[model samples]
Target: MVTIKDVAKVTGVSPSTVSRVIADNPRISPATKKKVREAMEHLGYHTNIHARNLVAKSTKAIGVIMPSSADKALQNPFFPEVLRGIGSVIHERQYSLTLSSGETEQEILAEVQRMVYGSYVDGVILLYSRVDDPVMSFLQERDFPFVMVGKPFEKLQEITHVDNDNFTAGKQITNYLIASGHEKIAFIGGSKDLFVTRDRESGYQSALTDAGLPNNDAYKIHTEFLKSGGREAVERLLSLPVRPTAIVVTDDLMSLGVLSTLEESGVQVPRDISLVSFNNAYLSEITRPALTTVDIHIHELGAQSARALIERTVDKTVPSRRIIVPYNIIYRNSVSEQ
Candidate 1:
């Protein structure tokens, strides 16, 4: 058992100095930290994370709550990319990540409660935002440290969150379709309860209003963020008396389903119908006649949320922040000049 005292003696530093180095305390000078770390490594001394956490009153773990079950969310590439980003930061900071596994809202809430009450995590990162979410309310009531990856339903200025300007992105993408001569444009979005869908849909409506285009309620379809949702949405669009020539899908995964369904229906993309989507996920490029989409920087959204949550856990006095990541349009082969 290589103890802190043994490493301290070997490095000619006090045991307390060695402990500070292990804790990564900023008060320890860089040179001393390096020396103590080297000596600890040479002596094969590994700090007991559990013991350290007990003393520091920190689990050094972060909880990530998904909008849906892990099985469903993982189907979308966005979630995986975001997790990768979050993991990168957590790994660097020597923290662990605990993902919520519950499949329903109630179950998820229970999982969150367990994480908080059981001291399983130092903070939490919410992967989605909804109106009057119980999870959000519970965290607020407890004054627990948490950060959301999307805009809050209310208290826009108070809740710490990391998100893209979804409304602007939506308007810009729709405007692109309009500029390319698309008058009858359709929108396919995820659940209406989600803040992302509402914001983007509002932007789409705003763009239509600005262009003096008809805003047909029938043209807007809301479904899950999965491929089947896109497929179902396309069925509705095709059955309409006046089918749209361009569609702005809120998710790339759903767009894939739209593309497949359209192909099966003999609707030539861009010739009969142009398709654009959000999230420049890898699959967007591989699809035949690749999709024109918005790059929302999903990874950055996750990384920033984790960073903010960690900051909050460290210093609760820090003011809440709204971090908005930028978006860019990836003009691919999916859109055509109508």
Candidate 2:
């Protein structure tokens, strides 16, 4: 119930000065700002966020629109790590985080519209990037500021995004499999429309070609980045007349599914088939054979996204909008010299 008026009275500053101090306006003299802050802390005065937002025309809140599939968001360690990174930066700036999940494109778009138009958030961070996404298009059309965690296939020049070089990560994994003496390698990846999948697939093909190995379409399977999808892709690959000696899965969760199916089939890992995966999630380390994976720095990715969004919200003139995090490969027991 403590209001800015009480802080102003205690600090002997005008209500407007107290308000400016609360807003962290640079115009307020440092002495006045310090006194106002001390009074606020002493009196336990918290500004009404809604009222402050209305007065300043900024929410000091950021909207994070994640995939509608709750299971995907919960099961994947990458998302949590990314969120952690974002939270770290946002908390430092005293900004609140609001998360919204949508199952369909339409639902997501509607939610985004509401957030942008209703002044619920100053900006948004989208976790997934698809080719020609309606959400991206809508935001772009209105000139609403937003950032994507993954790169979109189109509009590479138009929007700000943060992502690791997925194509390089894919190629590196593929090369690791090849160096282990595996010629027949299969790919189990995420949705085809997603830019991550496209980039990784390109990397896979590039690695094969560079190594003088034929890029066989039969060995490639595009599925959801889930355990079920991984299991199905592995099963299909195993059923092929020319089975793959190794597999490069785009997601760690999907790699777990591949492992499960392989174990159920009585196939020994690394001895019979080697595997590599992305994300380097905890599941990779705990599996029967610790998975070899590419560490895409998920937490750092999230943190960077948050920082970028905050910067855009604070100052529209800050340059160097696009940020690309780096990736590293973790060699594990899942792969051996074949």
Candidate 3:
């Protein structure tokens, strides 16, 4: 095995310099670091990560905590896009990412405990935030370095997070429909346990209240974050004694489900009932009538979370912070005048 000492001897640099280069210590000048890396490559010297971690007391790896329903959650496609953004940053920083998730909250909690207690990761990136989440509580109690990808339900000052302004997003989309003469508009969202759902619901309600439009309980529905959930919501909405003129779905996958249900029922979208959704994901453009949805910059959400987590791992004293990515509504054929 070509050791660090051998590489240092070949490069005429000290062993300490070689170690610092491997650690990517910023104090080392760029040119010297390049030279050290080149010498290591020439000598076929590979640093044993385990041994280095043992000596440094750092794993050089991060844990990614997904939602409890991870298998179902990943079906939405937004998660993958967000991860691409995160991976772009961390991969170059010499940090590896490991994922932990489960079908239930307790299962997810168990996975997180193992990762945190086993010293398997230096930090964690949480993919979702929910009300009274045990995983969040556990990380907080342990003073672990972690970053959330969504707004927390509370604790405005302590947790570091990256998210879009969901409240304004919901209000803006609702106001758009109202401007288009959609008075009997409806809202469909994920479980109320999620802060994303709560924020968006508040925005929607605020928009309706400002416009003097009726915010009826009959028009608001909550269900799973899945296609079937969207379909069920549409069914319930259409069956109401007073049908809505338009609908605001919280997710693109749910919107896709809504479109499918409408097509099967011979209900022409935009013509029959204008529709809008969030997370302008891949399917938004290809739907029979491209969805006029909100693009919350999912990629930036991921990239920024990774950046924030990396910042946390480097300095514990850095005050916890918040990063809000921008959002926009893309006009497509799915939404039309009432």
Candidate 4:
């Protein structure tokens, strides 16, 4: 088995120098580094990350905590797109990524604990934020280096988070509906437990208030982020007396189900009921009528969270950061004038 010692001997440098070269210590001269690396390649000396981690106290890896099980979360295109963004930065930094996805909150917390206690990764990126989240509490109590992709339930000044201005986004999109002559507008969102949904919903209500439109409680529906959730929300809305003229859905995935269900019920999109959604997922563009939605820049959110967490891991004393990625509206055929 090739070892650092063999490379050191061939390169005529001490084993310590070989180790330093492996660590890419800036103190080592570039010429010496080049020579050592050439010898390492020639001798087939591959680094054992386990040993290196033991010495440096770093795994050179980051853990990504998904909000739900992989099978369920990946059904929404948002997850894949965000992961691609995170992966881009991770790859550029020459770091590895570990995804921790569990079926429930408890299971997810357990996976996070393992990642931290077992020294599996240098830091973690939480993909979702919940009110009074045990996972967030655990990371806080341990003073573990981590970042969230959504607003924290509390301690906004202390926890590092990357998110869009969802409140403003919601209001802007809702205002667009109102300007298009939609007086009776309804809202469909994910679980109220998520701050994203709550903030967006708040903005939606605010828009209605400003426009002097009644913010009817019956017009608001909360469900899961899946297409099935959209389908379910549509069923409820359809049952309402004097149905809304337009709807604002919090997720593109849910909007897909909403469109399908509305069609199945013999309701034509735009012609009968207009819809606007969040997250300009790829499918949004290919749908029959396409979709008028908010482009929350899901990829940028992931990239920023990973970058922030990496910075925190490198220097634990660095102050927490709040990164707000900008968002814009993607106009499509889903919305029409009432």
Best by TM-score: 1
lDDT of 3 by residue, 165-232 (tens): 99999999999999998999999999999999999999999999999997699999999888999999
Which segments of model 2 are wrong by more than 4 Å? Answer: 1-54
Span of 10 residues, lowest total lDDT, candidate 3: 45-54
TM-scores of the candidates in the order shown? 0.86, 0.84, 0.85, 0.85
Candidate 4 clashing pairs, residues 3+ apart or interchain? none
lDDT of each: 0.90, 0.84, 0.87, 0.90
**Candidate 1: global Cα-lDDT?**
0.90
Q: What is candidate 1's lDDT per residue for 90-201, written digit by digit as tens?
A: 8878889999888888999999999999999999999999987999999999999999999999988879999999999999999999999999999999999999999999
Off by over 4 Å in 1: 1-53
TM-score of candidate 1 on Cα atoms, chains taken together? 0.86
Report backbone clashes per prediction. 0, 2, 0, 0
Q: Candidates ranked by lDDT, best first? A: 1, 4, 3, 2
Off by over 4 Å in 3: 1-54
Pairwise lDDT winner, candidates 2 and 3: 3
- For every candidate in turn, the CA RMSD to the true structure comes to 5.9, 6.5, 5.8, 6.9
